[model samples]
Target: MNWDDMRFLLAVAQAGSLKAAARSLGVDKTTVSRRLRALEAALGRQVVEVRGQGLNLTDFGRRLHRHAEVMRDEMQAVDALAGADTGGALGTVRLTAVPMVINQILVPALDDLRATAPGLRLELIAEARDLSLLRGEADIALRLARPTEGGQSVLARKLGDLDYAAYAVHGAAGEMPWIGYETRMSYLPQAAAIARSAAAEGATDISVNDAETLYRLVCAGHGKTLLPRIVGAAEPRLVELPYRHGALPKRELWLMLRRELRELERVRLVAQWIERTLAVRTSQAQPTRPPDHRDNGADP
Candidate 1:
């Protein structure tokens, strides 16, 4: 039997009378009666009997009502799933970033993100290695370098530069040893710059792959190491070295995402939050140069 007719049958069976069923279905009693008769004719069976004050369902009608109930439940389940899939600002957004940035920048600003987007959940992947946005590994990514190869599907935007400086423990003096990245990370621009400076001064003493470990080593008076200005500035014991020691190349931070996700309301909100938060933090950490300063015919 047609599902529409079955629906009318179920409604009439539950409501007991055509008038009540019509009230529930928002239709007139005569329309309900006509539809119920059509359902009975389609099944070729007398499914209802006219009782003194209401309609009573026959055994076949009761059986059909049970099947219709099951179909209604299944349809409701499908609609619920569809609604969840289309929900705009409610769901998990996976974000990936380097460990240092996650620890120094994203972690401190998470409360702001949660306050602004209470319906959005965050799944953070903190690692130095880049995760694949094209493979659906992450929804948003914060990287030190702009991606060179994700094709048109990838959207990359420069947020700001991560400035670095040599940090030494408070009250340390004399020719200090230097800490740097291990051989595995020597290809990093910061590492290469530190290595050259250390070699010229004969100051290399230790190497480590992780930025936190390097920071800790420097704090213990092991040696000075290049650290992100934001991290170094927060530590009371660490003092920034003068620029004359040679400047390390500042790494540009880029926000990367899949092009399709750029328009998703939740993702877009998170992206804007990250951009604003990092911009504020970076400005606070770096020293502002005078507008009048010019270097080699270029603005400094």
Candidate 2:
């Protein structure tokens, strides 16, 4: 009924608890709860179903949220039209990406749109979990997994096949630390390639999960990690441990958006930026040279 109530509704859905939402909103939990109750009562509808862990938005809440987003965008656009610069989109963009891409790729490419679309506000959430886009958890999701199909909503794009190569610290490629992604998430093609290549080169096995962390650890001489060749190339001495003699596993990366927000300008800008950044990197790549010295495969 009110933007305050709708904002509270989004907070509850996203934060998972009134307390959490209050913390995010920088207000008292009781106030958030009271407002939510009042809104539900005003609407004469059960907006949320309470759960042990958090509140789940009811069907009514879900429908209302979609409309709220449309209204939010329209209002934001109107406000921008009234006061915004001659050319640019303005508003917050929520993006969720896994660690490696966030660190190695996303961070560097953030300034790409600054000259063209300076009004875009980016709120990036880096996590490993598959977040819910339907609930407005994020505007765009860069995921490795194939997207869902045939349901309330659906859309897809085959971005490109991302390649992963095993790498270690300088002079340590032949004697790799042989790390794996955290614990349970290991045995993925990336990790498997690392294991296979390391075993081939007579190296030791060390396990880890997050690609960014694993890459950092490996850079610190803790172990070797399977990293995308392009990302790993950012640092020195992280040689490619390609599958077999010389092949990288083709791990496809896809850009997915809620079927609804696909056309939204903010989401589109971020997505296009990501794609453009990757394209630039791909095009500007130079052939890598072998290490200049003998292979001891140990930290200096």
Candidate 3:
């Protein structure tokens, strides 16, 4: 008998009723009934019997069910193999990363990524919180720190380091108001670092939850705030403060993926692109000398 007929038999055997089987299979009950009859006719034996209140599989039907399950598994394996072979590096890969990295770093490299793998599509989930890779919420992740809870099944690599520098609007100088992360965000390493640095410099008059918001306020001449060097360097209106006393702490950036997904061509390609992009960006980020305070309209 054909696999389609065997599928109906397996469904009916598992569901115990033609109506339930049809519902599960997305077909009419009559269709399932007909298929089962056709399969029995071809096999020349009764595979099922009507019990007191439900359908029961006969001895032969139970044996056939075992074989059908094996066939179904093989079919699934074949489908997966065929899809992978035909769609090499062509499907959408979901990536989750913090907003700053997406906007300041990854977005700049999109053109190169497209050129390298035109068939690959990207779905970016920009949020600070780590998305679940094991649950398939994301195919890849760029995290500031190695994830603590995704288990050993996750594969992570240290892509590069992100350096932070205190920035302010051009000409804004000494003892200026500082912007910092709110207490709610103090749990983050970057926030803690900013808090310590700001404490020694000036009073924090503004507190925000995200780096992008802090960046905007600093650029608007609101207050000096610590930001990733890459972001601060891109803003012409902003100038980096001298960290002569002590350099801001550097955080390591990580590229992570589920171990199972590493085999996919698209996943591997995207991971390589991310690693390369971050490395290049990090290398190109030159340390800028603290702007001459005298030029700006600030008290000497």
Candidate 4:
């Protein structure tokens, strides 16, 4: 197989389509397609298969993809070393996390990052879905729970714990309706708890996927929902519900990154900035006690 064709394979594997690969490689679609065909002919095996508008890797292609990633990382390491000699971390670091963490936490503290590493550029992706680190979709990811994927090629570390609390409109009286995550998010303990409470009360639950939307609906006096204390503390109009803090749901914040990128000066700088920022934020929101506290009506 032509070593040069490996770049085409790696590009398509990461982008999931030939057109995207062509765009990344600064070539036309025909060039990418021809290169892929030549690669397949050389190996006498297919690397990728068409699936609707996208392409999926074959078993043989997947093996090649892994090798391609190692090559990419090694090249990046060399570039990083060369760049490091210039005296400051330079280049972009893509970070992914849920919207609440992005909007409520990190976005507010971006000035700190600029001051620490003015040459560093951060691309923040705010979504619930995990982007592939090995595929170079994101350089670092913040997860609410421990990540199950990535094996040895990824590094996982605990940043801090996020405490949850029930929030509703200030001075609001009576049992407000329950606002919660959609059914698809029931894996979240707080979401499941809200589902149970709403179901038992026979109250029609309002469901939303994003934390910012959920917080807005709750603040509008439409319903009560669980929010990370760090998020809830920002709004004075949204008051914490009567539920005991100890009984509320809490989740650990985890940082994940590709092991290959760990040594890059820019990647390491951004990772440390994230760690420091979250540590300060979590400490500000940590609850004082762990004793018995009863939920008045909002269980979560």
Candidate 5:
């Protein structure tokens, strides 16, 4: 009997109906019906019985399904072996990004990545510090700042812009405290912006080291804090506070990697995955100004 026809039987048996099987297989109901008929004709026995809205498998059908399950597993094994031999995504890639981006963005989309690149592994470093790609500390990195130190060996591409905005919990009462960052982080433009706003608002003395903390504090209604629009927009409980004038601070989202390892299959796979993930959010929220393309860290 044809294995392709057996595939249809497998789907029908698992799904319990021709319509459900067709939906699972991405084919029309008639196609599933036709395939099942062909399989029955080849085997010269009734395999499936349609009763009302459900389908029941005959004795032979159960036997056939067992064989089909074995075939499915064998096929998957062969495909995996072939993929590994032919440079499929395999091995580990160390990726680093800030806590908010790691928690709110990358972590959520990992299942999708795993489905596509089952052999690939990820080492996610969630920190505000920029890890050294040159020192082999990481295979790939998603940074809010453009790399100015890795020389020609490091390749940097602007993924998109991360727009910032002040946010407070929905319907939060008058003069919500301004949650600022820790003193050492004051050099960051985002921190400076918050300091200016807090000073003008007569300040509340709350401070934190990271953006994720700022996000959680704002969600808890402790106060308003500067947050990436991408993060703030996703929380329905938090609303973007109106700006007095102009735009909030914008950070450039840059993807950085060692030029030498850029072509490695696993590194390339993770890099593209990171780019695709950020693209969806960045595209939805347009930056006030286009990303700065001047310092791409390309070899001169």
Candidate 6:
């Protein structure tokens, strides 16, 4: 008689018992009995019978069950069609970021972005290698460290400070392992601080460059590295190093895009998604000092 009656009849005809039907419909047995009685009363048909063994579906009940199945399929089709017109934006937006942020921050917040833009697609480049926006590398770049010199200028937004604190794998800080940078780079601000700290603390040096590799080296219980507290805290094994004297220097991370495409839809979506997703991490990275994350928190 109605959509609900059809659904109840369908459940009952398939389950064959009031108790079983009630469980399938997620309602009480009494409710199922009441609805069934009402359906039969309104239709003037013997839809069910109580036997010595249990309940049985009458001929009319079987007929209703077949139609109910068709009805369910029709309802599903209607729902799908109605939902087709809903959603905000669409299209693939390519984005690039350092590995630490990708692992610790961005990866976790993607589901929320999906909810915001159901048809939105994201392509993430997680390597440390600088991808060129002018050369078609990425629609948006999440800058943890300074951009590699000589790419192309773009519209940049300072996400926030990437707060750095001297950290080690638990007790490894006592034995300072200064993570150094790649060869051919000049003295960076953080490396300079670390060198001064090592000198001040009278500790030996352990050099490393790549941020991802440095994190791995620290995780293996090797030594301490000046890393973004927000990113490093995500790894369960690593612990903040005991500060020798003062607070470690902090570096502000920037979100950059192609200078020409600053207003493009794809770039805008990607940038908005990145800022919204990493806002908390950026906020956590308060500017306590100077820019030191030249290579995403790796020593200089």
Best-fitting candidate, measured by TM-score? Answer: 4
Model 5, 1-300: lDDT tens per residue?
A: 778897788778767998888987789999999999999998899999978879989988998888776666456435434434355548777899889999988887788788777888789999888776644567678888877845555789888778897778776624686888888999888898888878777556678998888888888989888888777777778766655534578899888886666656777788878878777766765534322223443221
**Tens digits of lDDT, candidate 1, 216-289:** 88888888778888778777787776544456678888999877666566788889889888877867777533
Superposition TM-score, candidate 5 onto the true structure: 0.64
Pairs of residues at least 3 apart in sequence or in different chains that clash in candidate 3: none
Tell me which residue pairs clash in candidate 6: 167-241, 180-207, 180-208
Error of 3 at 184 (Å): 2.1
TM-score of 6: 0.55
Candidate 6 lDDT, tens digit per residue, 33-67?
88888889888998889877578888888787676
Q: Which segments of model 5 are wrong by more than 4 Å?
A: 1-89, 286-300
- The per-prediction tally of clashing pairs is 0, 4, 0, 0, 0, 3
Off by over 4 Å in 3: 1-89, 173-175, 291-300
In candidate 6, what residue range of length 10 has the lowest lDDT sum? 286-295
Better of 3 and 4 by lDDT: 4
In TM-score terms, candidate 4 sits at 0.73
Where does candidate 4 stray beyond 4 Å?
2-40, 44-66, 75-89, 202-205, 244-247, 288-300
> In model 3, what lDDT does residue 123 have?
93
Error of 4 at 88 (Å): 5.8
Question: Model 2: which ten-residue window has the lowest total lDDT?
Answer: 291-300
The digit string of per-residue lDDT tens for model 3 on 174-288 reads 5567788899988776687777777776656679888878877887878887788877877778778765436576778888887666777887789989988876776776786
In terms of lDDT, the best-performing candidate is 4
- Cα-based lDDT for every prediction: 0.75, 0.69, 0.77, 0.79, 0.76, 0.66
* TM-score pick, better of 4 and 5: 4
Q: Please provide, for model 2 over 19-128, each residue's C-alpha lDDT reduced to its tens digit, 9 standing for 90 to 100.
A: 88897677999988888888989899988888787778889988977766666555544543453334655676778889887878878777787755678888888897
Model 4 lDDT, full chain set = 0.79
